[model samples]
Target: MQFDLAVIGGGVNGAGIARDAAGRGARVLLLEAGDLAQGTSSASTKLVHGGLRYLEHYEFALVRESLTEREALWAIAPHIIHPLRFVLPHVKGLRPRWLLRLGLFLYDHIGGRKHLPATRSINLHRHPAGAPLKGEFGPAFEYSDGWVDDARLVVLNALDAVAHGAEVHPRTPLTAARRVDGGWELETPHGRFTAAALVNAAGPAVLKVDGLLGEAPEYGMRLVRGSHIVVRKLFDHPYAYFFQLADGRIFFAIPYERDFTLIGTTDRDHTVGEPIVASEEEIAYLCEGASNYFKTPITPADVVWTYSGVRPLVDDGSGKPESATRGYRLDLSDKDAGAPLLSVYGGKITTYRHLAEEAVDLMAARLPALTGKAWTRSRPLPGGDFPLDGLEPLKATLTARYPFLDAGTVDRIARAYGTRAERWLNGAEGWQALGKSFGAGLTAAEVDFLRQEEWAASAEDILWRRTKLGLRLSAAEQKALADYLGG
Candidate 1:
């Protein structure tokens, strides 16, 4: 089929770009090598905040754009996106009070924040947020951010794109793309899709596509591996904790799901030629970081689950891992160095909407018939037509309708799927009607909805993407799920 644009990779970037393009009246097709968001897009830190730390590196533009997007995304997917308060405890030697205070000040005012609250100082010795912390630490500060269901955000964007005239296919890997006529003919495991414009949003595998066409960019990509650990419940507070290590880098201990605390993220240079796994050293380091701050220490035994992802950052010659630019760059390449092949590099999930708008804008030049300016900025993402503040009413009405669903399950599904929960329910009677139960509470009906509506092709795709049950289910349960899916 001919398309105005063909996007490779079903990750958030590809999905977002395709959605924007299709909404702007461009015929678009998005192909994923595996299930949607099975890659790095599913395994993010899950924060939609302006990189509060990026301000430390003087990344004003990236921080500004990302912060502005935080409110937009929360507005669009309020159920899945919500405001999170982070507690930044003051350490004696790591960072001075003035520096942290200044950072928080810029974090609030730097980005034109409207919906989120401003930062406030907290007495660690007195405030409950710091009761779990070591006594020696001085007062701390609290700031606002937005947390997202990182993977489902990608799926919802793809769903929106599909609703807006985009062909979204999963488990359909790209094979090759050779320039044909005035456009590009792309071959995938599924079939051939011809397009005048091609986009490489393959995350780590971006250069792989470039190599196939001998049109790779001049700069190489750095694959930085990051890992996170989910431990048994740590605290009862709703606020997330951010601690700076003695080594100057920072790590977070956030209240995750209901019965666990999520801690993570190490930035080590890596080269993953195959499926990546978390290094033992990385796991140990995370535990040690956790031990250093919390009054109650946790060991490796406390960690029930672990996950890792490779961040595909454009190598901007920054020697330090933290120095790499978080901003994305669009490179247009072609067979004869003239055709339009847009390859995206180094972007965060929070800023995807603007990036998609920009991608569509560039592709519009290739097809002048596609002219309507950007509409996605204002369009509700599928069920997001209702104001985010109004979700409580929807939840009240849903619970009143189906008392069988536990508060957790209903709230989670409502937040994850938003107003579309009705379609998933499809007049089901109760929990049993929702289908067989997975250990962490996801049902077969929810799983089927993932497969039919969200492009989930594998158990991992459903468990990890549409939901984070992978972190909550036991090994036996996971195995049963794998077997149930015919794995």
Candidate 2:
């Protein structure tokens, strides 16, 4: 059977495309070479910000859309996504105060923002957010944005796409695709797909897809590698910190998932063949950039985790990372304009929904028979339908219901899985009833649910993708889980 749309790559843009298409009543199939979010989506700076600094670059449209979505995403997924205030401490001899103020003023007005609080100025010497900052930096400005579990966000979108009748295949590679009479014929490890339309959201490999379809005009994607690092907790406040470097670039240091702090995002021009590892140069760059602003300095030894990804940007002929545009571009091509293939380029997590709406809306003009309208605007994603202002009540209820389960253990599962966490906890009379412990929150039941429902096929899928338990698990524990999952 032919699908209305076949989306390649299972990262944010592709998953968002599948979910939006499926919701819009398009028969959709999404394919991923590896697990969903195993690439750039999982390796983000993890801020759903409006890109406050982008204002300086004069990207108004990109800033406006992302700022608007910041609140929209928060309202829909309060459990997995929440509002975070960032402190941008002002330093002497850097971008002057007037310029920074102008940037923030525009940043505040750019997006049709509502839920999040607007920017405010605070004295660094007196405020708590300033305690960690050096004496040279004085008062700072604070603003609100959203923070999210970037990996799990992809999973939730994929889950919603599946719930909406889209076929989501992970570990399924799209080896080849060929244009047919009216659509395209594509092959995967599992089966073949015939689709009326194709969405080449292959992300970093989008250029490769262009070559697959016989290189069309303006067919180029710039691969810029960005890396992130996580270290032992630096401060107590939940507010995230954005520091301006000497090079006019900014890096983030956020109070991460409770116990640790997450910092990073270095933009360096790189090739795909290069190992996506944090080099000594990058580690020191991030460490020094962050430490220069903080009272307590950190070193490579303090880093607990690190990851990298390549952003697939449309080649705009600009070489500098700061000047490179963040706005996305769509090149819909075909022999005839009516029935064409859509190739997506340069999208971020913040603007994904709007991007999907625009992509499918354009496709609908081609096929007027396509059913359904934009429903994702108000609809909740999978388990995100839980009713509450927060997940604390649900966490409390889970703790009470599963008295036999440890408080920390129940909280972790409940928050991560929400109403569906029961699939992991159901009728377990005691800790022993939950089955063998796999260390951390790696229970036998959770692992089973991951494989059965979330398309987890390996230890990396379970440990890194499904859960951040890898952050807490010792090497021995990780190895044990790997060995067991391998068998």
Candidate number of the best lDDT = 1
TM-score per prediction, in order, is 0.96, 0.96
lDDT of 1: 0.83
**Candidate 1: regions farther than 4 A off:** 334-338
Query: Over the stretch 1-487, how does candidate 2's per-residue lDDT look in tens digits?
Result: 7798989989988998899988878889999998999998988888888998778777888898998888777766666777788898888888888888888888888788766688899888887888777787777898888888888888989999998889998889888888788778998778898988888888888878777866473556677888888998888977898888888888899977678888889888878789977788898899888889788998888898888888877677876965677789988885564346888988888888888888888778775535778777777776667653657888888878888667667666765777778777887777777776788757778787888889987888888777888888888887777776775
lDDT of 1 at 299: 87
State each candidate's clash count. 0, 0
Clashing pairs in 1: none
Instruction: In model 1, state the lDDT of residue 226.
Output: 80
| Model 1 worst lDDT window (10 residues) | 331-340
Candidate 1 TM-score over all chains jointly: 0.96
> Each model's C-alpha lDDT?
0.83, 0.82
Query: What TM-score does structure 2 among the candidates reach?
Result: 0.96
lDDT of 1 by residue, 1-487 (tens): 6888889988889999989888888889999988888888878888888998888778899999999889988888887888999999888877889999998888899788987889999888888887888888768998999888888888889989889889998889988888888888888777788987888888888888778766757568888888898898788989898889888788888888878898988888878674577778888999999999898988888888888888888888887886787888887653466558888887888899999888778777777647778887777786676886888888887888888877887777778777898888877767788888876667788777777777676778777777878877888888877777778
